[model samples]
Target: MNTRPPAARQIVIGVVLLVVVAMIAFLGSLASMPHTDGWYAVAAKVDWSPPNSVFGPAWSILYFLIAVAGWMIWRNGWRENQPNAAQKTLTIYTVQLALNAIWTPIFFAGYPLIGEPAWWIALVVIIALILCVIWLAVSAWKWSKPASLLMIPYVLWLVFASSLNAGVIALN
Candidate 1:
């Protein structure tokens, strides 16, 4: 029989991990605040672009789901005697998180300053971000099926966000 700690301790660890992920996401959002409004206000957004107000709640829910999915994968991998799979899973998760954190600042700060070239850069970053999330989803599938399933919404959001990014580029 596995001799892991009590369920309560595992629960606490999962919650802590969730909080860490949430905080990272929250901090990234906070960092983008200074540049957000000005850029959005002036950007040539497409008709399908979501209202600015929609972003916060959408991101909040997505971040929460991301954290939970990551925690589930972590928990599943933690039980293994060898940690290779866990390490790979967590590395992919970390990469996606890093990509997520940087995207806002890149789009907000870099776009306006560079003019048309910025659109290409932004599109590249968005595509990279999408790929990273997809990689995370696949890695999570190996670690935990439910965790992989949980990432579907996040991937879908990234697709929609990519469309919005592309639309902005094309419109502008």
Candidate 2:
């Protein structure tokens, strides 16, 4: 039996989730924005790297999709009597969200502030982030198909980004 709260309540929660995710992205951007012109401009990047102009808009869209996916799972995954599935689903969601949250500072501030090791460290974190994303989609599939499907573009973007990071490492 579906144990979801009323639609109105659920909608309110979703809107809140959306705003929260946006805030997380905004905070991350604060760490990242300064570096794009300073460190990133000179950093060795893949020849095919999208112009710096592309990241902000791309991330804005991705963050929206991620928020929606999280909301969908929250709506569909719970049963009042058996909350285990929902708890696990949200736990995975949180794990991925946390990984996403930490990636920006590690990448943008790593080299300039922490020395050469930060690049490799950031690469590790991004790779873990990619894996967590894939895992979230798979786990979310049991609760919400749309949530699962929503992660595809994110996965693709991350793959492209990981390759770009790898290239940066290779060149520099």
Provide the overall lDDT of each model, using Cα atoms, as 2-decimal numbers: 0.78, 0.85
Per lDDT, the best of the predicted structures is: 2
TM-score of each: 0.85, 0.93
Clashes of each: 0, 0
lDDT of 2 by residue, 47-67 (tens): 889998898899889999999
Model 1 regions lying over 4 Å from their true place: 1-9, 80-85, 112-116
Cα error, residue 158 of model 2, in Å, equals 0.6
- Writing each residue's lDDT as its tens digit, candidate 1 over 15-68 gives 886787778667767656766677667878888888877988889888888888
lDDT of 2 at 156: 93
Clashing pairs in 2: none
RMSD of every candidate to native, in Å, equals 2.5, 1.6
Residue 3's lDDT within candidate 2 is 74
Q: After TM-score superposition, what is the CA distance of residue 8 in candidate 2 from its true location, in Å?
A: 2.8
Off by over 4 Å in 2: 80-84
Alpha carbon lDDT of residue 8, candidate 1?
86
